[model samples]
Target chain A: MTGSASGLESPAEDLLKVQDLLVHFPVKVPLIQRLISREKVVVHAVDGVSFSLKRGEILGLVGESGCGKTTVGRTIVRLLEPTSGRIIFEGRDISHLSQSKLRPLRRRMQIIFQDPHASLNPAMTIGRAIGHPLQIHGIVRDAEEVRQSVLDIMREVGLTPEDQLFDKYPGDLSGGQKQRAVIARAMILEPRLLVVDEGVAMLDMSVRAKVLELILNLKRRHGLTYLFITHDLATAKFLCDRIAIMYLGRVVELGPAASIYAEPKHPYTQALLQVIPTPDPDKRRKKILPRGEVPDAIHPPAGCRFHPRCQSVLPTCGWEGRDFIDLLDEHLSTSPKGVEDDELLGSIGEWWAEGFEAGRKTDAKDPKKLVERVKEILAKAPPAMAQAVQSVEAKGEFVIVQFRTPDKLVHTAVADRTVECLLYQ
Target chain B: MKAKHSDPKRASSLPEIPLPFLGRLIHPLIRERRSLAGALSWMGLGILFFFIFIAVFAPLLVPFSQTQPFASPVLQAPSLQHLMGTDNVGRDVLSRVIWGARTSLEIMAIGVLIALAVGFPVGLLSGYVGGKIDRLLVLIMDSIYAFPGLLLAALIAAVIGRGVFNIGIAITVIYIPLYFRVTRSQTLSVREEPYVEAARALGAKSHTVMFSYIAHSAIIAIPVIFSLSSADAILTAAGLSYLGLGLEVDTPGDWGRDLSDAQSFIGVGIWWMSVFPGLMIVILTVGLSFLGEGLNDIINPILRKERS
Candidate 1:
């Protein structure tokens, strides 16, 4: 009964393949302001991310908030349109398909949201909420049949006293009951692929384990494949078959669940795994904490986005002129007495940085004096940054500081696994 | 734990005011809000039901036929024989005012129904589709909304010409934008709720999502608006008739037209002709408004949830 419907298709084939999917949101500006500036800004979310899921596989997309894991799941289900890239589901490219064309495909895939209170309509009774999807997809026509099927699903999701809870609204139920009802709504149609987006994140800790167990039981019973999105690595370890670590909208590392936990290749993945507390008192773990906050996606750091905070950074780590500008700004703000000229101090923000070169026009009396002064400033940089700074020279009235450019880290094989870092390369 | 337990005792030292049984009966209404809107609503409903009774049994209750001319001495003052006295045409003023209830209620109820019928679907489409069609319909509704209700009613009345049905149409036009604005805005917000999105994600057709999820949830506030709009409808219809733009001069029953005819007699001290008709208008409108306010008390969960 479980595999009879989809047995003809090869089990070894990929169920869903995503290639370089990008979902960028264009920042809206006032009409007059936009016309005068002629500049278009966009939030680079879910930039150049790719992954594939096989049938019966539960792939976890784990990352911090705003890492675009949720966006990736939404794009796969066609909830949010992708700005670019292909999403091949069951060998069909559904990347840019129209809503009408996607309607039939929606029956095969479903999404369970995090907040169960918000996911179900407040005005609708629990019975109607669960059974409505069945009626909509033409799986059941009669109201009584719909009710019986909904009750069956409710029982399957561990919601008992089905008769007592049938006519109750979402407001009447507890947090766990609400979530169980939400799961019943998603599973009533028996979709092939379910995208669970932090589905247990909002439930109580006591109820979390039970709901997770229920999800696993349902997956096995129905032979359902899942693309589980969560920030909790512990839950992902318990649930996901394969884990992909996302950093600034890119899959920095991906492999089997056990291997990622035992030996994380990417610095970002290692930092995440290190934070999990172990119960053993004798073993003191050396925690690798990344510096600073996740940078704004609008102006992501040049080269590798994690390079600015990477503990194992190399001399060629994707540092651009902006890095120099940031360093200069920090120096000026901390100790301002070194620079006396008001004009030069006021014009420091006018410095331009791109690629590996950063420069600013100076109003100095002599070019040689400005060159000497710029070199003195570069000398005060930390040892790592000082080594990366190749040269400082004054050309006419412009002082240019250049840094050695490192190669961008593509997905490189690390033994049996894959990682995106200069160290792995 | 001991300090927390003593806090309630300290707060309870202030004496509590004892409420009467009637006060306790309506306690839910005033417990959280501290508003007179609830009290006024009950008063208004009482006035409205009184007129509904008058209108329903106008013939049986009246001493004389409202349409019969010279049934009594013209300019007769209030007496046992004539409770509200006679009009300028010698017809019974009390009977005419009683019969006027039927006319006013008909225009108010039917006109609001017409407005809701026309405005709801248009608002749904304008809000749901939401681009060029939305912009165009919004522009048209805003133009109508810009005018004062009576002035708009007059303008529409002049074009459509006057009679019972025409006056109803005029009032309908005046209030259509109110319904459209309310329903459209409600639909706009309800369309964004996760439940509506959940329905769409389940492969529900556009119509199914619109009717089942969006419309069902969005229209909760509509009934609250409906009662209030009907009250406004009564005032607008009366205004149109007061300007001689409603029923004909010899019409048997009309508050606005009667008020118009009674104005000439106001200079002569024949107060019953004007006062009776004007008083009925006030009572009926007030009744409708109170009914609306009362419904608001029950329908709004935000107000009800806090106390319960």
Candidate 2:
């Protein structure tokens, strides 16, 4: 399967390179500027995401919903423009190319959509729709050649009795037939790169496996580069050689599919593995129950993004100033907003002072030194708008923030397999 | 992707039924009492076709020279000498009616045809290439749709000063927006379809995708709209004659003018004067409406899928 990658990674034969890509969608309210100005909150849908495909590597991006897996796939193909990123395809900077400039490139990259029924035009006969690409790319001159090419591709996709189906409209085909017609259309141009966005997600379970096999077969037959995006890791394991696990708009785990699945590094990956239903219940194992719903993208948790849900959270997890405020906000069960109602803000200030005082006790050996540190923190006035300070220090050792942020992505850690969790540290 | 070896026999048996899908697609027309409306349509159209055939060959069919005036009795009423009862001018009433069919259908078909030719392309372009082009076409068409179709046609006739072509060109101007609007909407939805995207991926130019993929969906709706528009055109032509803006008042030979003048005689209880022309309008409109419905029934998506 990876023999195709040799052509892709070779500088002369490279197909596409995606580097540190970020696609932030600014949630806009129609006709209301004052209501939400630099109030312009950005959903880090795909943040600092980086990956590259050698000529034929099948890179599977696996994640749950809102993981930005789909965004990465689309941005790399230039289907959707990246907010800030570089998409180098065969040595050309295609990231911001205009529609006209992108025309020729489109002939080399194709996408097979999820909804088979919605993909093919109901008014067009299979032959016209399939032959459409051949004529558009100017690959075929004669009308007869175009028809013959469509028939050949239709057969390749396992559409048996292709001649009989030629004159039929998409509305006539069943789910499987429609999907095959779509592949027939895609393969007509023999694109170098194919983005299959959960391409088989919509099919019945029985149909899903067969479709996946067809894609595998096509890869061998055509030497195609596939960026298979799916929330199903199991499918990724089945189809991809190397899999990247995405979380909160970033890749937190990636490595060889066989290696990662057997020795999963990311706690999120482990939790996901446990959830896959086993047909044989007798073989079921204890599932890891990660806490909390996925946080709002607009204002994510400060430390590790997964801190709130990670069972093994470290206090040192990306706990910066934002993490402090988030914990105070969590404690009050209220957000601090008004300067006039400075009471909540004051309490948040005191909370931080108390947190520092506790840290002093743990670091200091002498009781007198600990007391001096607490006095110093209390003596200083709280910052403006940050009015008062809350004090609840027992033995005075640690401040408890609500959650922790996982420090690194999956591949960055040098474990035998790429896993994204503090436990590896 | 292959069907199972023992896939339910009931699913396979579905082809025997007329495909329940056909019923769903045509269900709206049935509910609209369109199927019944079709009866009035076909019966009327058959008469119109017969009338047109006779009118085209009036001299040959009727065996009478319209200009050979007063060769027979000056006035005759329902005798072997004449079928419908002759006028004071001594012309056969049947021959005039037969001759009149030419003017009646000619104006109607020509006016509608002109509207479709211009409106279809405008609608197709406006819809597929949305944004400035679409907005501009939509605004212009909407303006025409906003104007009352009859009043607009009348104004165009008056301005042109006089001619059958003027009436047709005017009616087309007012109703092109209808075709434009329908075509644009169909294009919008069709463009979003995967097949269109597939075409784009395959490197199809904007024009190829627009015409090859999007325009065909809009074609289905044209028959229904065109038939109805022609009905309106027929009435418009008649109104122009009523206003003395059509076919010239000196030529009392036109159906609309004949109907308009007969209205003055309505007070004298001359029912035949108003009745004949009124029936002509009703017959033509019914004919077009039935044909439209029949087309809809035949091409209805449900039925189309069933046969496929």
Candidate 3:
């Protein structure tokens, strides 16, 4: 443990440690599903991932979407219970502590999430959400003092006129504002180390930069250490002091962030860098779409997980027959940014929003007639909007309204942030 | 090993700007889903509520305030005086129908509350703490579920001596397993959600973890289970009354007794006596199912629809 309270020379060595962590999920078949159940298997989401950070040092953990980066972040904060691991914070292992024992220590370790919306409780106002950690840690008992503390944390996250944002629900806040609320909640603890798991990925590109700047500024001001888990090598480079690239369930490379990006050693690390969308159009030609789809976690390949699809394949690379088709499929899927989803979701949200707004403004003369008219308006909307609106209308009608679609596979990495594939080999 | 200076001034733990939602004493329930314009999804729910309105606020709706008809002949057929006709006791079937709403509905609702009130905390503690506690709770619930619910309800009814409250208590005991299973499964899933972890990271106690993060997630399961158990509750209560072991035989406003009493008169072909009470039960069950399902879907879409 490098980051203890007694006194170290720099913020970079205050201490963050994870010892031999493991998390395995059980997948079982119902009696009817037995024939196809094949065999009971465990999806080892995280296997023996261990690393540490100093008081203010940023330890960048980079990997593809399912490479367990987020799981590792959650586990360190004990958000996801480790099958067997030790999380040492400020030189004390909190692993396996009873909930009672963990309570006081909780204020010392906090986390920021990828989806600001999902991470926040929608029913709570942003200020309450931020002040929650303060209350839980018993930082302020007096009502007046809690309010002042919340406003100050809000300012640190860059929300203006702190009073204005104090009353907004997570639903009302914009992407950046929601992210700031999450940060405010985590920071209220004045935690020594913050686990930020792709915290800015959900924001718009323009807003993302501002949020990232706010984060870096907070780090400087508080001397807060960070365990920044991301798939984006570029963000990792910008935010981390040191970087560790995970593949399958293990770190394949570890070094200073600049060196790992500038001079990657592992084949997975090299491939990830080569795929970065280079600004110099000439340099763009070198983009290497990763060769294989991320294996279904429940049934991963044997021996060196990336070997099956590696162009740098060798007898030692763990190449297998299924790897070829998987590689071809990957090449096909990455030809161009697949159809942009922003436009579709935006159009649908807009249509539903308009319909609901109109529904509210409709004269009270007859709700039935208003509903019928709303239905007609929805039928005439654009295709995506029409579907979204229809669903919204049926909402509270046939069933409670829900618009959950399949969680699409996203290229979560921004620039040279990932360390999967084999181009850097 | 190394350490860093603890700088109190730089804690900069203060907000950079304002936070809007702070200082609220309570969390507001998100009024996210509006119901079918409250039009009443099923014909049964409408009819059930109509009858209830007549029973509770009878003077307002019905032209005649008398719930107890003064002069109706035994086994009488349908007429203006006795819309559903008279039972063997010579009481108005329609009055009984209106009054029966209070009895059956109270049983269903109270039984469910019992299941939730008694079973929820047990299920939560079992799943979250796990180990010996989980096994002990599981053993008790598994034994309860092992009994055929109706027979189990009958046994409890028999033991408690066939009264209205006895029948409901019996039903509540019989159905505790369903609530236990539903709640335990939900807690198992919710305890793993990220926010629960986030809450724990903030030093939230187990009680807070149980009620705060997991409860809402667990609550979505409530409507679905309520819908499910309401169906069970209605059927079991009706079954017991029909069997002569539920709701004391001489009790007024008994739908089960109405049905059972309707049995011997069948030869005379006065079917509306049995048909109306049976229909009332169907409506209440179906209405509850639809409303509960509708609520669940709005609150937690993923549960309503699972994808590959």
Q: Model 1: per-residue lDDT, tens digit, B1-308?
A: 67556467545543222322222224444453435666666676678778778878888977787587886788889899889988877888888887888888888877899999988878887898899999999999999989888987888889988777888988888778888988898789777777777787888888888888777655666766787888888888888898889876666689988888899989978889999889888877777877677757655764244113
Docking class of 3: acceptable
Q: Estimate, for each residue in A1-425, the C-alpha lDDT of model 3 and write its tens digit.
A: 33544553444544778877888787765777777757667888887666677677889889989998888887777766788878877767767776676677777778888887777765467787788777776778887899999999888788877997887667668888888888888888887778889988878889988988888898899888888888887788888899988877776677778877787766777788887767777655655655647776676654456654454543333333233223223433553533442221112212221111211322234345435544544454333323432133323322112222212121123344433333333
Candidate 2 has a TM-score of: 0.78
Model 1's CAPRI class is acceptable
lDDT, model 1, position A343: 44
Scored by Cα lDDT, where does model 1 land? 0.82
Q: What's model 2's lDDT at A366?
A: 39
Return the DockQ of model 1: 0.38
List residue ranges in candidate 2 displaced over 4 A: A1-13, A25-28, A32-38, A41-44, A295-304, A314-411, A416-425, B1-82, B86-92, B249-253, B290-308
Q: Candidate 2 on B87-165: residue-level lDDT in tens?
A: 4455555555555566767777778787788888888888777889778877888887998878888888888866666
Residue A412 lDDT (model 3): 28
Point out the worst 10-residue segment of candidate 3 chain B by lDDT.
B20-29
TM-score of chain A of each: 0.92, 0.77, 0.71
Return the lDDT, model 1, position A244: 94
Point to the candidate with the largest TM-score: 1
lDDT of 2 at A81: 87
lDDT of 2: 0.68
